[model samples]
Target: MLKRVERPVLKDIKDACVLMKDAAFPAPFDSRLEFSCSARGFWNIVHTGMLIPEIHQVYVCAQGCLRGVVLTAAEMNAIDRFSNIIIRENNILEGNNEDLIVEGMGEILSKLPYTPKAVLVYTSCIHHFIGCDLNLVYRRLREKYPDIEFTDCYMNPIMRKSGVTPDQLMRKQLYSLLDKQELDKKSVNIIGNNFATDDSSELVKIIRENGFTLREVPRTKTYKEYKDMGKAAINITYNPVAIEGGIYLENKLNQKHLYLPLSYGFDEIEKNLDILCENLGVQKIDFTENKKMATEAIINAKNIIGNTPIAIDYTLTIRPASLAKLLLQHGFNVVSLYVDSFIADEEDDVKWLKENYPDIKVYSTMHVKMRFVDRHSEQKILALGQKAAYFTGSNNFVNVVESGGMYGFDGIVKLCDLMIDAFLNEKDAKKLIQYKGLGCENYDTNCK
Candidate 1:
């Protein structure tokens, strides 16, 4: 069973204020009194991150408040330079005015000579209050337009702190397609590639080498191809954020769902290989050559940084866990682990850690107090998303903020090299130290 972390309570008002300041803006308002002013305000924030890509087209259909405006900005930021087009719908509100939204969609649909690959309809908080069933709206639109794929993004504008994350929204959209696919017994589905760090090509190579056929679901997969997904023998979930869809697939197809951590470490790769071999009933590859390569690499790495103490704070729990296991095997003292969250079959991992390295400590963000241990640790390894990297003050250590996908034997070597570099470089070490408020200048400071 996976260990669960309790949520933290807020005690610092100043920290609360800082969180609010950093939070994304609330969705737009549609009242006559605030119409012009709200539009200007929304546009300013929108312009900061909005981009028109050429591959996909976005047509904003806002209802209630200006939630559509806020969502459009975020979507635009996510798709920058991806070759997509974004066009705003003229009728942005539907009070008792459903016709406005309908007509606006019609106008946009008519203007396009060819139906787009996908059509996303965004809704505000008002739409939810008014009981607008976007699923119904999408079904209706699909029946009328037949040629285009339709989806909806629910952006609740009223609750400042309750909006759906971009990741959640994207998963919701993708689930719609995954639900329609037929199950195959020999094929395997790959979940958790958000186009952010999903190196699909490399993943495919690894999966193929392990003797399983791979299918990836994205905008690129055709409707027919996606519908045939029910055939996969099993589903390998790489990212926790993608678990929602995996759950759906399990229920619908009765396919086995295995959650694996994404990391640039040999142990993780070995675990993944083990899972594939077991599921497919295939013989394990003689890892004699691969193991030798990995062993030699670690031996070389340890010579440069023997017995160094390292700390890791990452958005994904699997990354830290996998990387920590690798480093520990290479003679590093993994003092403290700070994880954002953990979602997987942790039976093996927990057992392995307890039986072999019982002294290593793991903490979730809620219970983490990094300053207490920073003085004792010689270096830190921060394998996190950009946001978490900045939040953890890892810039003071020899840190590497990688957004690209890392997997297989080659990836493990690269991760080991990064750790070695971090251990040896004073500049990198000092940067991380300052970021975490562990510099000599603040040696007496208490973070609590």
Candidate 2:
């Protein structure tokens, strides 16, 4: 039987505030050893950033490091696009592993049935420790494959917290491939997250009304289409990770960028839309109708979930604190939250929640105490995100895997629908949390 955890009661939202303010939550606990119930969300980001249709990959890493990704590639049916060069122990100690990598690249280009437009070479954390000079290896590969683009991708999990994460660094490298082109003030590029925004997005409607074309990498069908994104005059980033890429484009290509971070609060969303319009020099498009629809959805959900205690997790959205604040404003009883860390950009939301809703409890997923099941609290309730459902014993939960296809007014509406559905339905949250389902159809990689 699974063990229950002791509910860490906060004196109020003020005590919850100390959790993020001073990092007093938990000790360093590794979650990799735990069996992952769902990796579909993470693979979505990988496919979005790494799996360019015309670009092939050559992954250099230890056999152990390659096992999971290799399996993932096979599952996605994208095995043909992936190649690996196993790094031996001697290679790391003696240095000079260029020959192995060059040989792998050469084998792929010469033997592949079709030509690849580019080749992305990835190295694991072993290189971080041994300091493998990849620049020289890249130069050699460039000489050998002058017709194809070569990019150095890193898969370093060790530096996830210390520096720009693998995802953030990958964003910078992806945009660096865009060749300089003539600016198009009528065009806009969506950077950062791989998922394309739904058509109902107010931001999309506003851009279309202004006669601007939206360019998103995931929606681009070909390599040429992806490259054409460089011509965009404005880069609008939805996720914080993509801000680094936007900054790079501004510095390197002189492209203008507007950061439109996703928000659940209607007022904040309106403010973000205003900022976007100002940056693009487009007239403020009226969002009153969409706002009303979103407001109605929220009201309907609130009516069904009146005073029901809730738990939210960071995996559902980027700004958990912001979402919690919004929920509290609507009179939702958010009894607990499961968050590993506070995102630097959303610190203000955390502060606001601290001051306003001081009664909500906070739990750290990575706390040393979390290693052992605390057979204590039996508070079953509605939850958002899989992790939150598990920790709170919530049977009614919204299983939003990632921030894909979620943004603007449409995002708000969909979230409201999910919350309502969870309230109306009876679900086995424990079973849902443990099921290791197949990859999502949108990002399936079927490799033999």
Candidate 3:
């Protein structure tokens, strides 16, 4: 007779039971059993890679791991631009790993109907484990395809725990194809954004007002135009994740770079705008009307939803902590926040929340028990992001991710509008979140 083994209880949201005051500065519940949501889909590596114009991606990885990227490409209706090579058990066991990547990529290029300006060869963790000669592989590819640009990309998840993330590296790699060009003083390039800056955005409006040509990678459709990014007078990176990419541009091309990250706080936004104008050497446009509009919008939303507990989720932006502090300052009841870590920019905001709002719960959405999150709230609670909406089990949520093309003081006003609309109506979260990318025009989902 065999003895029965009892299952151990997995530590989760209920077990950790975190609150704001008790939490640390950066990571809260850093190491814990995580539960991933089925609807948890944002702009992933596949989508990120597609931003470059006239570039084909060939990923060499296991079949199981390839499914997500394959589907992502298919969903985007861009299967033609994507290819993958399956890594077999024998290939790993046997030697000659270097030949696998070089030869495999060669075959993919031969099958293509048209020539691409560049090819991103994505090698997997298996290659790293076997110590595959990546240098030899890229050198061989470059030698063979002298006319075509051969760029190295990595799909290694092991590096996620240390150093720069795979996503950060991917963004950096995209700009590597840019060769040095004569500077175009009136033109500027903004890097590391999947979505184009909205025309209505104050950032875009201000740049145009200053008589400058603003170029973003996503908006480029031609290979020449994409390469022309190297010639820009200034390279601006607004997202924190893309800071390294910005630095790479400045170092390699000697192009002036500015990091104007978005913010929820009024003071930060004003300071960022001033810095941007000063760098551009343009007179600062008066933001009196913009500030007035944002102020009015904030007041209107607060008046409508008085004392309604709001739950903040990381899906909205990287600055969820800052957003929570901003809302709390404005008298909006923010009771819960769901995130893994806080960035350096939010140090003050995190401290403010922890000290001032000690009772506010800080829950880990990744915790295994988050799947069993309490859906019932005594009052009608408002959720800010999709994950927050799903976890809180609230139908009323502002369905936007990755900033939703919102920037500058206009973004503040637009956010308030979203809050007001979310409070007034209900959305089918199950149906809406079914689409992978929020602003991404991909996905053939009928519900979308």
Candidate 4:
């Protein structure tokens, strides 16, 4: 049985509030778990590098470590581009694995019908533990294939505690092949997620109005196009994980960048837009129509939802606190939050929620104790995010795989529409959780 813990409202949390890394509740609730969310997998980050058309990847790790990504690649139909160098126990002890990686990559490249312009040698956590010299292997591969560029991409989970996480390091490594080029002041690069920003996003409009060409890694088809992304004068990063890469480009290539953390709150989104317009020196576009539509949609959903407790799960979003703030602002009774840790920028939202909506209890899907969460809330609640639906036992739930291309005011409108649909239609929660990709919860199965 799961027991809820009680704590003071945000104002009473402390006279001088200090941001704590762990959950507000103590013990098992605060302890983190490895419970995997069906919402995402390891390959989400892997494909960010491998999806490049002209690039081949060599994943050098143990067979056990290789299985998940191998299965995922096959599932995604991207198996043809991957070759693995499985490390054995003996190899780790003996420590001369550079030859294996270099030889394996060479053989894979030789057999390929289409010659690759670049090869990424991805090493796992075991290599770091054994202190395997991947740099040497990368250098050897570069020497062997002078025409093909080789980069050292790491999958080392051990270094995750470092200020720059493995994902952050990997995003930075994606731009390693980009050499300094003549700047294109009229061009802008969105260096971040594999997902494309919503075409209706204000950010997209601002870029176009300024007459700047937009470039994103996922949208690039050829090696030349990928390389040309470096030519952009500005980089606007949506996710914080990609901020390090933006900084690297700025310092190394003299490319200026603006880091806009993803936010679900309308106010925060508008504020981000203001900063974006100011940074790009573009006229701020009006979002009144979008705002009006979103407000109307929210009202319609709220009329049907009434006072039903809504649980917003963190797995469905990169910014759960911001989303919760948005929901609360719309007169929704957000009674439960399922989140693990808060990012630095989320502190303000967290504090505000504590101060204002203190009745909302916080839960952790990643908590080790969640294994014992058998009791569902008595309230006939509506859940947002797949994990929230799972834990809360809510029939009326919004199931989303990530943000589902949701951004800006347009996203808010779509979200309200989804909420209304969930309330009216009783979709099987099990089937919805199993479904993947953008708008997976919707009737349309063709969405990628």
Best by TM-score: 3
- Model 2: lDDT to the true structure: 0.73
* Every candidate's CA RMSD: 12.8, 4.7, 3.8, 6.1
Per-candidate TM-scores read 0.59, 0.86, 0.93, 0.86
Candidate 4 lDDT over 1-448, as tens digits, reads 9989853223232211223233352221433335554544222445667646588777889998888767655555566777888888788677668777877787788899888888887888887777777678777877889999988888777776667888888889888888899998889988866566776777787888778899877667788988998899989887877899999999989999888778876677888888988878777767777778878888888998887888887666777788888778878888777776666667788877877876666766654445445536676778887878877677778867557656788778788889888877766776656643333123122112
By lDDT, the best candidate is: 3
Determine the C-alpha RMSD for candidate 4 after optimal superposition of all C-alphas: 6.1
The alpha-carbon deviation from the true structure for residue 252 of candidate 4, after best TM-score superposition, in angstroms, is 2.1
For candidate 1, lDDT tens digit of each residue in 1-448? 9989754534332311212112222211111211010101111212211111112334333333454443443433432211222223433343432544455567776766555555555555555656655566666677777866655554443543234455544453454544434555668877654322234334455567666667655323354555556578687766665676677678866777886656545566677767767677767665567667767777887787676555665532345656666777668666655443333444444445556776664533332232122222234543232222333334324333322344566556655666566555534333342221111112211110
The stretch of ten residues in a row with the least summed lDDT in candidate 4 is: 439-448
User: Mind giving the per-residue lDDT tens digits that candidate 3 earns over 1-448?
Assistant: 9999854534354544588888887987767566777555467777888878788999999899998889877777778999998888888888767888778888888999999889888888888788888898889989999999988888888887789899899888878899997898888888887677677878888778899988888778787888989988888888888888899999999888898887888888888888878888898878888888988899999999889989988878778988898888889999998787878888898999888998888877777776666655666889999888877778899998878768888888899999999999999887887666665546432111
Distance from true location, Cα of 26 in model 4, Å: 13
lDDT of 1: 0.47
> Per-residue error at 233 for model 3, in Å?
2.2
Error of 3 at 412 (Å): 0.7
| lDDT for each residue of candidate 2 in 1-448, tens digit (9 for 90 to 100) | 9999765743333322233334332321234333232323343324544435588877899998887677656655677888888999887777758777888778778888888888877788887787777888899998988899898887788866677888788877777678888999999988876566766788887888789989877677788888999999989887888888999999888889888888887777999999988887878868888888887888888998888878888778887888888788878888777776666756777777767776666766654444443423565488888777765656788876555567877788889899889988967666555432223332433111
Please give the ranking of all candidate structures by TM-score, highest first, separated by commas: 3, 2, 4, 1
Candidate that beats the other on TM-score, 1 or 3, i.e. the better one:
3
Give candidate 3 misplaced runs (Cα > 4 Å): 1-12, 376-378, 441-448
